[model samples]
Each structure stands twice: as C-alpha cells, then as structure tokens.
Target: MSQTPLLPSRREFIKQGAAAAATFMIVPRFVLGGKGYTAPSDQLVIAGVGVGGKGESDLASFAKTGKVRIGYLCDVDDRRAAKSRQAFPQAKYYKDWRQLLDKESKNFDAVSVATPDHNHAAVTLAAMQLGKHVYVQKPLTHDLYEARALTEAAKRYPVVTQMGNQGASGDGVRQLQEWYDANLIGKVHTVYCWTDRPVWPQGIPWPTGATSVPPELDWDLWLGTAPFRPYVDKLVPFNWRGWWEYGTGALGDMGCHLLEAPFRVLGLQYASTVQASVGSVYVDEFKRGYFPESCPPSSHVTLTFPATKKNKQEVTVHWMDGGIQPERPEELGPNELFGDGGNGILFVGKKGKMMASTYAANPRLLPLSHNQEVKVKPTLARVPGGAEGHYAQWVEACIAGHGNHTVSAPFETAGPLTEALLMANLAIRGYDLRRPKTTGPGFDYPGRGIELVWDPQQLRVTNFEEVNRFVKRDYRPGWQ
Candidate 1:
C-alpha cells in the first residue's frame, strides 16, 4: 500500500513525450546575452501547481535562486492565480495539473506543489513517478497513508524532494539541539507546543445555502480527490483550513512549524500512544452542537514517543491550539513575553527549560537571563539566510541532483514527521466519531475516552479499527 504506483511510469512517459520535448526549448540565459552566464539547460525548470496564496510566494522564492525557471503555472481558479500568472508572463498556463504533466512533463525538470493538503500527494506522487524533483508545502500530505506512500516513493524515485517547513533550516532549532547535546537543559521529558490558530471559524455547522460556482473557478477540478460538495462561500482562498474535507485543521496548518523544533531536538519519530480532548460549541442553551463535518473549535492532544538515541527516557509532547497554552514557567519574570506572546514551543528538561517562538525562531533559555548563563557553542553549520533560504536550498539541491545535495526537510524526514502529526489528528477526529446507542435517544462516542495505540508498520490503530478508515481516504472516481 505504501508503494501505490501512479498511472504512467517514468520510462513510458519519457518515451511518449520525447518527440514533443525535442522540438521546443527555452532560450538560454547566455543566449539572451551575458558573459559568464549559466546556460538555460543548467537552470531548474519548475511547474507551479496551485499558484495562489502561498504558491505565489513559493514561486517567487524559487525564482530568487537564480538557478530556477518557473516554466509552468497551474491552478483551478484563474482569479486566485492572477498574481502569479502576471508575475511570470512567459510561463505556460494550465487549468488542470494532469494536462500540464501529460503535455509538458518532459519540458520541466521539477514541480512545486502548494495546493491544499488533499492534493499534495496526487501531484507529488505523479511528479516523482515521472522522474521530476518536487518541493511540496508543509504537513506533506492530508493523511497518514499518503505521507507513508510518499516516503516510500521518494526512495524508489531518484529525485530530490523537500517539504516547505522552512524552520527545519533555521538556526534556532539547531541551537536547541546543541543545548540538549551539551546537557545544559538536562534530559527533556515533555514538550509543550501551542498556537493561537484557527483564526478562521471552526466548530460550526456547514453552510447550506445554494450558491452558483464562480465562472473562473473549476469547482469540479478543485474538488479533485475530495468527495463532491457544493461550493460554500469563503471556503476557497483560506477558510478551508478549518474543514476536514480540504484541510488538516489547526495542527496541519501549524504543526509542521511548531513540531519541527522538538523533532530535531530529540530525534523523535512515531508516537506510541495518543489521546485528545476538544472544546465544545453550543447552538443554544438546550444542546451542544454536533458538527462533525468541521474540526472542533480547539483541541489539546498528548502523544507519547519512545526513547531514542538523543534522549534516554520516553517523551510526552503536548499540542495545544486555539489560544490554549501551558502554564508559564516560574523561572521567568511575570511580565516577560511568553513564546512570542501568541505561538510558541516549550521544552521542559530535568535541569532547565528552553523555549522558542514559531518556526523555532528566537531560542532562549527560561528566566530570560539564563540564556546568558548558558555556554553551548555552535556546532551545526547553518543554512544560508536561515529560514529564508529554504526555497533556494531545494533549488540548488535539484541542480546538484538527488543524493548529491542536502535538503532540510526531505521526504525522508518530512514523511515521518508528517505521519506522526497526522497520527495525532486521528485522535482528534476519533474523539468525535458517533454511533447510535443500542437503546437510547443519543449517540455513543466510542472513540472518546481512549488512547489510540498506533502500529506504524501496519499504519493503523491497534485497539480502534473504526478510525483506520481515515488513515487512507478514497479518491473520487477518475482521480485515482
């Protein structure tokens, strides 16, 4: 199941598109006039899928490398893609990624996917199968099975791949790792990662008003892989993050950024056991609302990870969202800011505590002044420009070819990281699974009040079979 092959294999596609690729070629940088300029063939040609929102900035960052060419732009909504299309006027445009890959797969050397979490694996897997390097946005995929599949596919395909968790390249995480290594913070047993997210609405009933689909947006194409649903107002652009159909909720939206620090600091992997509790919403005084279609308003999840080489004892990581945060350490001054004031990660070690803001930025020891008392020397080499260099890092790696270069969050790393987070997501969704009671007027919450035991190799919850359906969702017909 981890090695599900896409429709067209690399060898077959290469032979099929050989003729179309041979006739046309872009003018080389040198041909356009400049001494000591690299040839166009040396540049990495990338196809931009989902060229809107973050996709626009991702393309801009990739182009900044001076070693990449945005050769193609693909998006379902032309209005959302207008900025990117105008920025890269010379790039070919397409409404469907399949058509772009079918006709121009041979032309581009790589593909950058910044689509919603649901479409990440679809575009990424196809690109990898075609022998193209890929850079996908964070959280890697929408489900655990997809993350696992992409991981195995990365090994099978000889191409460079990266996840857009730029913080993995930041110096702060490396600093935290060094502190742990030097024993300045003793042995970390617990970590608290919190965020004030879900800025969009959640825990609300789905909108039911009948509305017309916008002319510029291909509603059917946008709903690729996900079940067919009527277009809800404001669901596009951003609000989709709160809905399970299209996004991974708050954890998916910010987990990659917050969790990267601890994963790097302790060399964490799969979680052994997981449990979660979510906040409730009420439609009126009489009853609490039950809107399973949307993610809960907020959640606090606890995951237990077995001991690793970096840490001797097993670790417990807590994920808090929707303005929830752990108690402030008494070592710090009361008025001092806590975790960039809104979003932050706290590592509690036997001897001391260390924390950082989102993206693992601004690392400092507890008590603020204790940072001055610490004397851990820098050991890990830093990425150029830190977090900002993530884009160019992947570009240079693609230029250097698969194993020849290093990417901060390659599938090898991002895959497992994403899987663990998605595993936690199961607990969140499971907490809401409902069934009719044998002889009652209400539903039985069987998935609640339980700790989900995970079998990573099998990719399922050992104790709860019902939640496994979410591990690997079925793609809509014609999509798979």
Candidate 2:
C-alpha cells in the first residue's frame, strides 16, 4: 500500500492499445464453422455507405442483431453521418464510398448501401466485385440497366445480397401468398398499387439559384454518379427523391413497398408491355408547364406481365401515385378504408379480391370478414421477427456464404421487381417528351398516347425508341 508504481500516460496507453489492435488477427466466422455453423463470438463485419437517414436506421437495425459489428461508416454529408459515427465510435469513417470500398474491402464481410438511388448500383457493384456481400436500399438502382446488371451479377458473384425492401421479409406478403396458392384470390389477373407521396416537391421547375454548400457536406461526393450541379437548399437529407437525376420519383420511393405483395403473390416477373398517362401543371392560363427534369405531380402507369406457371393468365398491374388511388372495391362498407388510406395495394381476381397496406401489411380478402373464415396452411417459411428480421436474415445469410441460404429480396427477385417499377417510369417519362415545333413558340408532345412493348431479354421498349434512353442513363465519368 505504501509503494506506487509509475503508469503509462493516457496517450501512451492509447498508443499501446492501437498497436495491439493493429496486430490482432480476426478469423472469419465462416472459417471456424467450416460451412454451416457460426460461433456465438462470430460477428458479421459491416461497412455502411450513405450512413444517414434510412441508411442510418438500416445500420442500427443490423447492430441490434447483436451479431453485427459496424466496422466502417461512409457518407458524403458529415452532418448526416454524425449520429452513426457517435453510435459506432470505433468504426472507421470515410466521406466517399469508393474509398471505403476500395481500401476496406478486405476488412468487412458485407456492405450496406443506403445512398441516393443514383449511387446504389455503383457502390453495390464494387462491393460485389470485391467478393463482399451487399444490402442495398429499395428501388435497387436508379436506372433499369443498372438493375439488370446487378441481377446478372448476383448470378455470377459467389456473394450473398439483399435489397432493402424489408417488407419482402414480412408475414403479410406470405399470408397473401398462402391465400393465393389456396385459390382464395383465384388467379389474380389485375393488381393496383398506389401511394400519396412526393410530400416533397415534384412537377416543378428546379430551383433557379444555387446555395452555399453545407460545410459538413462534400457536394461532389454526394452527386456521385449523377451529373454535376450546384448545391441547392434542402436537397441533401431528403427532397432529392423528387428529382429525376437522383431519384425515380414516387414509384421509386414507394413502389417496392406497395407492389411487392402483388409481385410475390402472383409470381410476377418482367413486364411484356407498359403504358402511362401523367398529370400536368399549368404555368398560366395559356400553357401547360413542362418540367422534364421533375416528376409530374401524379401518374397512372400500367404494366402487363406474361403468364407464369403460378397463373396461366397474363397479369395486369396498375401503379398510381401522387394521391391517386384505384376505385374502391364494392365488397367493403362505404366507410371502410381503402388500402390503409393514403397508400395501399388491391388485387382483383376472377373469383374475389384481396388488398393490403404498404409493405403488404394487413392483407385481407375482399370482404374483410373472409380473413377469419379462410385458412390455408402456410406454404412459405416466415422470417423471424418479420420485417425487423430483414437485417438479421441478411447477416445470417452472409455468414453462411452465397447459395447456402435464401434471402427474401435478393437481387434476383429485387431486380425484376425494380425493373418493373423503372419500366413503368420509362412510360411516365416518355409521356413528357417534347419536340420543337416548326411553327411559332410552341412544342409538340410526340410521346403522348404510346404503348411501350418490352422485350425483357433485350432490356428495351421494342415499340418506342425514344423511351429507350430512359432504360439506361450515362453515368458521370469518374463515377462509372
């Protein structure tokens, strides 16, 4: 008690700890399991790109699994990354996703992409090429070409992948599937999905002036693969969804959630044809506003899919957005809610009707009471914890390695789903095509009243050549 020994200073202690960490060897859990098992100590190392907003929440859910370690966090906006950085203080941070993937590819087991729709493909493709598993947010990619590329890449890469449409793991869709398999909805040929989105701006002209870039943001990095543009107020955290350059508008925003149930229940794949009509804004008494860069306030798009084995008859799916909804079914009371109110999906079949809210939640037959009477044994396995389990499902799958287990929204499934949504977008975009008129100060809308015949194999609208440009967009040089 009388003798006290000299101790290293706090800085010295930190230096020693750093040295120890540098030398520590992390044996991957897969090595210990020898294929099918994972030790309790084994953790899935995750590197999150675009760690803000939804991305931030996605990482938190993964960490909640108790089997995941947030090893790296990357985002263009420092302000957006602040919370994640604080939560995972030990995680290395980067402002650019490319640097995170390029340098840390060997350090992490999987990558979670929560970036804007535009960068989703670029980041995910790089991670997959590095032999890392990936979890990308919904609407998978900004462009149809990227979606198809990822779909094909999943087949080639020996890595696990999941798209962030968590609803895919929810029991509601499975319940709908069970009922459909039991013929409760008898060969659903027509489906309607709608949402009241664009709570942000749309169908408006781009802001005329640029604002000083946020000091915490790397504006160039935020743009990623999209074209260069000056920073605009309120575009970073959100509001980007209304811009075509960075988002796919309302469909891209909520299509995955609302359309997933119908896609799964009907076993739908690529669409054979797509058609659309969009609402317009009037600039004045004499002219209708034309803002090709912004998504219209509302739109109605129809996609026809070829018959699958699950149903011999072809299927027609209609998508409505911007407060648009399908006609209410007659089976329900006039006072009853339609598609969980503002957002929902409805399936009309020859025998009966079925509907569900966003994320396919609260699935029910035409007559709500029928849900209590009809019981079909579950044909599909349910994800533990339902939607909340989506994160753990990917973590477990990544640990098991590719092909060892199935994920709910792998690129294979998500790609087709996303392609369908983006295909519908092609029609929406096509509707606004404008051409210079030979006469006075006016323009001609040549794309109006067109049916786009899709050839899934070729990834093109066989009937409409102009709309093909929307099928795939050119990326900014360095980003590509």
Candidate 3:
C-alpha cells in the first residue's frame, strides 16, 4: 500500500498487444480438445470465393469450426473481400474467382460457392469437378434444369454437399415436421407460405441507363452465364434479388425457408397442377425484369397434389407473395394468428393446425387452446446445439467420414421443394387476366385442379405434354 507501480499508457499497451497478436498469428495451429489442443497431423484446407455479404457470415462460421483453415479468399470487389482476408491473415487473396479455382484448387479440400444465383452452377460445378466438397447457397440452382443437373453432379462426385439454407438444420423445423407426422396438426390439406423481401430494390421495371461501366466492377464477369446486358446500378451487390436475369425474386429467396417444413412433413415431391392469379399489384410483367419480369406485384399460386392410391386426401399448397396474405382462417380467433413480414407455413389439418416460420426459435400456433390435452413427445431439440450450427454440422459430418447422417436439406428433399417454389413463378407466368380468382382447388381447367401427373421415377411429367414443356429449359449455347 505504501508504493504503487504505474500502469503502461494506452498507446504503450496497444503497441505491446499488437506485437503479441502479430507473433501469435504466425504460430502453428493445433486441434482444440478438452485436455488441451494437440497439433493435428493434417488439417482440411478450405477456400471461400465470395467473401462478403452472406458469404462473410459463412466464412466466419466455417473458421470457428477449427477443422479447416481458410487458405484463399476471392471476390470481384477488393473492398468487400478485405475484412474476411484480415479475419484469416494466412489466406491468399484474389479478385477473380476462376483464377482461385484453377490455380489454388489443389491447395484446398473444399470450396464454398456464395456468388450470385446466375453464377452458382458455374462456380459450384467447377469446384465439384475439381473434387472439392461444395457448400452452395440456395435456391440451390437458378432454374429447373440446373436443379436436376446439380443433383446428378452431386451423385457423381463422392463428396459431402450442403445447401446454404441454414433453416434446414433448425430443431424448430424438424420438430414442426415431427408434430405434423404425429398428427398433432392432423392431415394437412392446405399450406400458405409467404416472404416479405426485396428490401433493397423491388416493385419496378428494370432500369434504363447508359452502358458506361464502373471502374471498380468487372461487369462482364458479373454477368457470367446470363445473356449479356449492360451494367445497371439497380442490379448489383444486394439489389440482384429483384432482377430475373440475376436473382430469383422473393419466392426464390425465402421459399426455401418458409416451404421447407411443409414440403418435408408431407413428402411433397411434385405438384400435379399449378395455376396463378396476379395483380399490380400487375401480373403481365412479373416474369419480365431482373426480379419479377413477368411476375405480378401481388400474385397467388395454387398447387394441387393428386391423392395416390395409398393416401386419398389430396394435398393442396398455396403461395402468396408481394406483401400479400390470404384471409386468416375463420375457424381461428381474431388476432390468434398474425401474418406480416417474412415467411410462414400453415399446416391446416382435419383436426388442429400449426403455423411456423423457418427461422423461428419457438414457432407457436393458433387458438392457444390446442396446447391443452395435446401431449407432444418432448423429443424436440433446443435451437442452439453443438452440431446444429450449419457450418459446424457439415464439419462434423465431414470428420466422421461415415456414420448416421442427415443431409440437412439433401437434393432429394430440395428437388421438389425447388420445383414447387419455381412453380409459384410458373403460375405467375401462366396467369389468366380474365380469371382473377381462378387459381385454387377444384378450379375450372381441362384437368380439374390437377394439370399433369408427376412421374417421380422419370423425374418429369407423365402426362399433359404441353405442361411438361415448361419443366425443362434450353441453355444459351456456351452457358450450358
């Protein structure tokens, strides 16, 4: 108490800490274990290409797993990629993704494709061909054909694959399915799903601008495989979500989340019939632009699933988007259910019903009274488990090599989900101007509400030749 030693000044302390951090950064890493991390003989070297936006979060999550060391980072904009590079100082950096893939593929065990929707197939397919495990962001593929092709490619390459729909791993989503299977929601005859998106740029026609390009951006490379077009400020970075050529609209963006539980719970493989009613809330232009070129401002898509001989209850799914929602079910009390912002799937059963959001920690349902007398098995897992983190789950799966496994949202599950999601767009495109409320169960059509029977084995329509034409797409020359 008689003598007090003076502490280092803030600048002095920071300088010393900086030196220590620099020294620690160069040190050899080791495996983290309870007994104290021992150095590993081998570590999975990983590389991330699109290192900003959603990609940055993916990179950080992967880095935290400790199974892999980030060896390279790539992006078109150096400014965007800088933070991720500093986050992993040991990693090399590149502006061009192809250079990263071609030259550095040997250095990496896996590569993540977090680029735009249009470039997903090109980058991910190249990585797969290079024998790297690919973690691609969802809508998985841009169009129906790419969906089928990517699924086939995954089969050919013997590597772990995961879609970036993190909601797939949510215990809440799994519990939602389990609840449905156990008849807690009875037989779900109808599902209403919606997404509130395009917060960046939406509800307008593609901008008309002079073609003078920005120096910072490589517009040609940005276009990638899509049919060539001049650079527009409205269609870059984040706003791509609103463009048809670049992004897949709100339905494509959030459908994977909202539709995931309903699609899984009911085993909905393909829709027999799909139709749409669009308003300009305008239907004519929904599918025309970068986002909703021909899509309506507000549209409702109705999907009909035929009742197989084994199960007679016909399943019907309806998608409502553009900040629109169907009238709340009258059976449920007023304010018992609220629909606004983002997405939710309502499973309407013969008995009780349940509604849950994809990312919801605790998805609650209507009437509150349904909770009484119902005994849920309590098999549901808490939200944040050790392996439940999307990146962590994939890392754990990769380490085990072979064991009891789940693909989170595997291609098999995602295939029909994509089909139905895309069908919402299709219904929007096939909208009839005269028939405003024409898209629904038991509507007037040649096939009643069922358009074409789905042949799961063949992965195509078994009947209705005209409708089958839309199930596939013709790629533009070199792009395919």
Q: What's the lDDT for all of these models?
A: 0.90, 0.87, 0.65
Q: lDDT tens string, model 2, 1-480? A: 111112234575455344224423557666877987767457788999989899999999999988899999999888999999999999999998888876776677789999999999888887776677899999899988889889988886678899999999999999888888888778878999999987888899999785999899999999989999988998778889989999999999999998888778878899998899999889899988889999999999999999998888999999999998888898989998898899998989889998899999988887988878877888899999998899899998987767888799999999999999999899999999988898998788777877889998778888778888887777799976
lDDT of 1 at 386: 97
Better of 2 and 3 by lDDT: 2
The TM-score obtained by model 1 is 0.94
Predicted structure 1: clash tally: 0
Q: Which stretches of candidate 2 lie over 4 Å from their true place?
A: 1-41, 439-441
Model 3, residue 254: distance off in Å is: 0.5
C-alpha lDDT (0 to 100) for residue 328 of candidate 1: 93
lDDT of 3 by residue, 1-480 (tens): 011112234575455334223422333444344345545524556778788887888888887877778888888766567789789888998777788876876667677778887787777766765666777777877766567657766665555678878777777676676677676667777878876554555557777868676676777767777777777774667888766666777777888877877666677666776666655533266643223353345667788876643225788888877777766766567655554335666778888777776453355556556566566785655435522587777766555432335557655566567767776665554342123246665333333243445554454545544444444544445655
Clashes of each: 0, 0, 18
TM-score of each: 0.94, 0.92, 0.79
User: Which is superior by lDDT, 1 or 3?
Assistant: 1
Off by over 4 Å in 3: 1-41, 281-295, 307-312, 337-342, 380-388, 402-404, 432-479
- Which residue pairs show collisions in model 1? none
